[model samples]
Target: MCEWVNRIEYSLWTQHCDEGRRFGHMTKNISECMNSILKGVRNFPVCSLVKATYGRDNSEFTVAETTLTDSFSLGSYRVSLASQTCDCGYFQALHFPCPHALACCAYSWLTWEPYVHQLYRLNSVFSVYRMGFTPPISEGFWPPYDGPTVIPVPNKRRAREGRPTSTRIRTNMDEADPNRPKRCGLCRQPGHTRRSCPQLRGAEHTRGHD
Candidate 1:
């Protein structure tokens, strides 16, 4: 299931999720995990993201039973043990084996560490950053300027030929931002949204009257 705010957010910050499961320990675990990750890598890239930022808590491996399956369910998790995925989306999203997957590993008597993506492993991350970066020399130390300058291109700067639709890409962060004064789609007026637009109401009113 999708959780809007974490348990720590509700219990420590605000009481939003009374019905939700309590994971008070995660506050410390998450903090320490992020701390270790930051200590490992400060930069981000598509390929290195999972490896530079993977750490499973000690809490995950403490599974109770010895049972393996293509599917496993307990509380919030709906894990597809075969595909190595969870309904929480953390597993596939990070390309690292999530807590749910690790739990399955424990039950199956399989080693938990191997289930995680190699990129997220400590040894892999440490190996890359171990090499020191060579310092770049100043422009004065550079070779003589020999290349021809190629720079006349106003035609190349023109916008692509297409009807430009006024739409912005929606991101997950947008959900947390405060609602803005929406513009009406019908009459193109500010202050009211498309749903509550007076122009739409007026049109409907006139149609009903007719």
Candidate 2:
């Protein structure tokens, strides 16, 4: 009887036990929640983006928990933070407080706007065009130099018989910048960068005049 009991316990442990069961897949769970939120929200055009140029208030905020209200309305779908957002699709996509988040704000009085921003809306995502600049006017005008000196076009070498004429070669122009100034990011000075700064290197003797 004891031997039979031991065998049964060993079989259960070996066959049924799993390490993954003990440790939950948090990443998968979060991804699934995001997917659910996306599916529920209605779609919006990407070009209909709002210009959020100026920075938001940097004041520190306290987080508040909001309870779901009965019979909440979110466009087509009912409101559910448990579902992570409403059917309107505002809460999840922007990651900032939407109308539903505002409702949550009213109930909790905990500043749902901050939560909407902190959890979902990343500043980095919006920063893509923050430092955007117009392309500089090219010094090389159209209808390039009609100079007198007749520079003959170099003739291509004849391809070997039965060999392909096409060949792929990498160019250094990718790394080379014509307009990029040879200046340092630190101290906004010219010549060596901050990384190679003598001042930073503690070599006072090597520090040159401004």
Candidate 3:
């Protein structure tokens, strides 16, 4: 067991050390992260909030000169406002400005809205529901069916059994290895299960002996 455990790093086993360094929080979950991102916008209307939040200042971030005009340096990270990307990788993956990108936006006196994907915008969402779907026609006005009807064979019908079997598609995961030994539940021994265990049968027969 110790040899098996030694094969993997200790950071993977416990989240204590890695969680703080990676996410800046020891116990932060998805819900908390979302709440932090949309903090003040909850009280306002969706469209109004989007506009209002975009106009808000990010004056906390201090501007610093980098090698390139479009890029900004944040310690180990490189944020490019023109390309809409950051060295941390969250900008491209989440289709929005990451911490580094947002910092660069603040430094450049630019709004973060342009860096966000169109799919998340209120106008794109409103456009989707603009076209009204026509209501489905009633079954009474349907055309008559001239095609041959399907008929089930009487012999093909399944007979009543103790329990109805599942019709779900089977996969490779369902197959058990033939080499594995079956163990007895009561005795914790191999070869037979608890139902056919000799010790259990003897115990049942000698119930009044004690």
> What do the candidate models score in CA lDDT, each in turn?
0.66, 0.53, 0.75
Per residue, candidate 2 scores C-alpha lDDT tens digits across 118-141 of 534567577766987898778876
Q: For this target, which candidate reaches the highest TM-score against the unseen true structure?
A: 3
Off by over 4 Å in 1: 1-68, 127-134, 138-210
Q: Itemize residue pairs with steric clashes in candidate 3.
A: none
Local error of candidate 1 at 34, Å?
51
Q: How accurate is candidate 2 locally (lDDT)?
A: 0.53
lDDT score, candidate 2, position 1: 78
Q: lDDT of candidate 1 vs native?
A: 0.66
Better of 1 and 3 by TM-score: 3
lDDT of 1 by residue, 1-210 (tens): 336445334555443543433333344356675666566455767456566544333234334233334577757888876676899898888877787787776665678665577888888889998899999999999989889989969755645787655469878976754666656887788887888988788999999999
Encode model 3's per-residue lDDT on 69-166: one tens digit a residue.
67777889988877778889999889999988887777667788988999999999999999999998999999898999989897677768766567
Highest lDDT, which number?
Answer: 3
Q: 11, model 1: CA deviation in Å?
A: 55
TM-score of each: 0.30, 0.25, 0.35
Superior by lDDT: candidate 1 or candidate 2 = 1
- Root-mean-square deviation of each candidate, in angstroms? 34.0, 34.6, 31.4
Error of 1 at 166 (Å): 28
